[model samples]
Target: MLKDLAIIDYEFRQILLAVTIDIEHFAKIQLLDKLEQRGEDGYSIVSSFLESNDRCNKDGSVSNYVKTEIDRGKSGCYTNDLVARYPSYDYPVWEFMELIPFGTFNQFVQFVAGKYSDKKLRNSFYRLQSVKSLRNACGHNNCILDDMKSGRPSYQVSYDVKNALRAAGFSETTLKTKMSNERLQQISTALYLHHSSASDGVVAAKGDQLRYIVKRMYRNIEYYEKNDVVKSSFSFFKQVIDAWYFNDD
Candidate 1:
């Protein structure tokens, strides 16, 4: 579980970072137009948003949080390569994207997506909330399989995610039943996003890692045979892995 959780977190970060960088590069003109409409400068959207006081942090403003991250980056306590790459007190979108926590990156994604009014990007931001929740749970060493009941989720699962699951051979009844469980829904959503967004090389590497985990999972399968909830959940996730990562189609 630990290995799988770590890989999921790492892959999600890579996927989100790649998407954000693509948006910064490919949508520069559209972003500039949107900024101009709001009377914000094109030089630094991050700076303008920080100045607006739109979002507040517990410590101070969002900018304070950003400054703290930058200071941490420069403190030489982080990875040597990361510290070496730290900007000299001036964080561009790209630099900040690398330095900030996953939760902060999610907020940044929402900010940029909202500014551009892109439906697809906005949907991605919503989907990422689940991934973020799972990532935080993993970071805190929470028991991932302790609660497996259905019928209570804080948010609706994305339609795209459901479609992907369906394509992976999940029945309509199964979707409605299993996805009602928040944790399962979040896990499936994260897997869907990673499969759809990551580069082929990344997908292949992670798939191999997941397969090894799944093999380990079944090694003690007899222990969970009587526990329908745990057993079914494992089976369901294995199907997802096979379809999304190993399928030729």
Candidate 2:
């Protein structure tokens, strides 16, 4: 379970960072047009980021990204200087994306969807927020499985999980298990996070890695089932593994 969790988290983080870079790049390009339409200024752009949000820091201190931007401004910053500071900040993409004001974030989402027309990507800004929330839970070592005995907050399963399950041959018996019955919510969220920006190579390699894990998990399940052994918590773990049907192709 730990290994699997690490894999998912690692892949998700890579994709999240890639997506964030793309988002920030596109936002800078489209900012002037959006500013004119909304009658805002460059300060609004800077303020809309997470650095400007007081609630973002648990210690009530400004984020390192914000401080870095401030320091650069003291040295006579240019417009491009503001853009350069964003990528260098050592912050999680999850928080970075959320700190953006909703309206501004929405426009960015629209910009990406309209420009790319990539149907595989989620166009809803809210889905990006959901991915961020998922990333936060994984980063904090929270229980991701909905029915697992955990104190972590429960999450609504993404539709992506159901679709993946369908493609993977979800069984009626499997549907009754805790892993599946919980709605495959956590795995689905992980899938969406990866699909949001992962390249074909990364996704394929990760999928192959998961296939090995699934095989091992299935061996354990079969041994327990055949021996009439105690149905341990690992049974739920196996069920979750069975639902992972991701394919790069």
Candidate 3:
């Protein structure tokens, strides 16, 4: 189970990073389109938002990040005899997303509603926040089960996720059961993001990796059972994994 956890953590991080990066790209596209439509200057408008005092911490997070970058440059972040470097984004796509507070994504979605017809953007923002939480947990190497139980998942299992689970041979009822458990919520979130953001081949490979790890874990169940905490967490995940791997319907 310990070894399985390391694998889970590693795989989970990969999923989170991929999803977050995609979201970063998505936000950049939206911002650029909005700016273009408004006939606004990009750098000036964005800089104003960042520098504004009325903008709350969440709204001005990206500004703070820019400030940090400036500070790093002043401090000579990477000064050498032949080279000098500082954190900078040529296009600022991903870095801009990272700087924005998670909550701002939702507002941005609403802000752009008139520009786009798809209502799915709101759902995407909701899921993005959930993905952020999952990313934080995985990035920090926190106990996944505990994080899920303590935190609220950003979005419930949507049709995209449902379709993925269906393709994996899980029925609606089974998917519901799998998602209802807070301990298994991260798995659903991971699979959802993987389905939405990754290519078909990549998603398939991720699914296979997840199944393989669970199978190995099942074989070593007794080893995990020796510890009460491991036993409990493993049991929670085992039900969800087994359902995904060996769907009867």
Candidate 4:
């Protein structure tokens, strides 16, 4: 029973991680919808605005707008400034795209709520925030990834586990099981963080920095479902990607 319970935690951690991405696809479709809604004339406006800067400003600097805003004293866009600051970078570095749609954290939250009427994007944001705090605790808490090998149970996930359960409208004590893939849950949450980050197409498109973080999840599910680890370990993600890829079919 204990093993089964642990496994359930492990499994749902992965599942929660996976389901949370509903917001991502939500964001992407929102983006595309926003773009198409803007249409050619809208794109021309974005383009003309950029014409004032370097020619290939494909990074989307849109200096004309920035300068106009700067003159009015409304200038703080995170993209260019954070790279210069070596310390105390409070502006969610990963959330770099704030210059555009969902222009700020509050706006992003509002976007989620408006775009997704039923899901309580605000609650998810807080849950994600709680998970993020737990992640910080996990990442910075004395048990660095190096120490987890000692196989001791520490406060690695106490708060996060409770908050995540509450987010799911469930009980906080539900996290006591060892069978769960907390890592995957963390991974999924990490992915959400990465997506919600302030950065953009230039960075996120780089590769699996995001995926690698989440991959540690699904350890138990992997063990039971495989002759090898990799396949079962990320099976949840595999199914998701596959379905997404062929979704149009």
Q: What local lDDT score does residue 183 receive in model 4, on the 0 to 100 scale?
A: 48
Clashing pairs counted in every model: 0, 0, 0, 18
Task: Please identify which of the two predictions, 1 or 4, would achieve the higher TM-score against the true structure.
Answer: 1
Every candidate's CA RMSD: 6.4, 9.4, 7.3, 14.2
- Candidate 4's error at 18, in angstroms? 19
TM-score of each: 0.74, 0.43, 0.54, 0.27
Q: lDDT for model 3, on a 0 to 1 scale?
A: 0.52
Q: For model 2, name the residue pairs that clash.
A: none
TM-score of 3: 0.54
In candidate 4, stretches whose alpha carbon ends up further than 4 angstroms from where it belongs are 1-121, 141-181, 196-198, 202-231, 237-249
By summed lDDT, which 10 consecutive residues of candidate 2 come out lowest? 175-184
Residue-by-residue lDDT tens digits, candidate 4, 1-249: 336434443443443334334334354445445445535233343333333332335786533443333233233564445433422222231222334322233344444355446254555455454354434444343222211112333335334434544454433333343214454445434444434442454233322333333344443444545333333334544433332222222
Q: What are the Cα lDDT values of the candidates?
A: 0.66, 0.45, 0.52, 0.38
| Off by more than 4 A, model 1 | 1-42, 54-63, 79-90, 247-249
The candidate that achieves the highest lDDT relative to the unseen native structure: 1
What's the true lDDT of residue 135 in model 2?
Answer: 49
Give residue 113's error in model 2 in angstroms. 10
Candidate 4, residue 162: Cα displacement in angstroms equals 17
Sorted by TM-score (best first), the order is 1, 3, 2, 4
The candidate 1 region of ten consecutive residues with least summed lDDT is 19-28
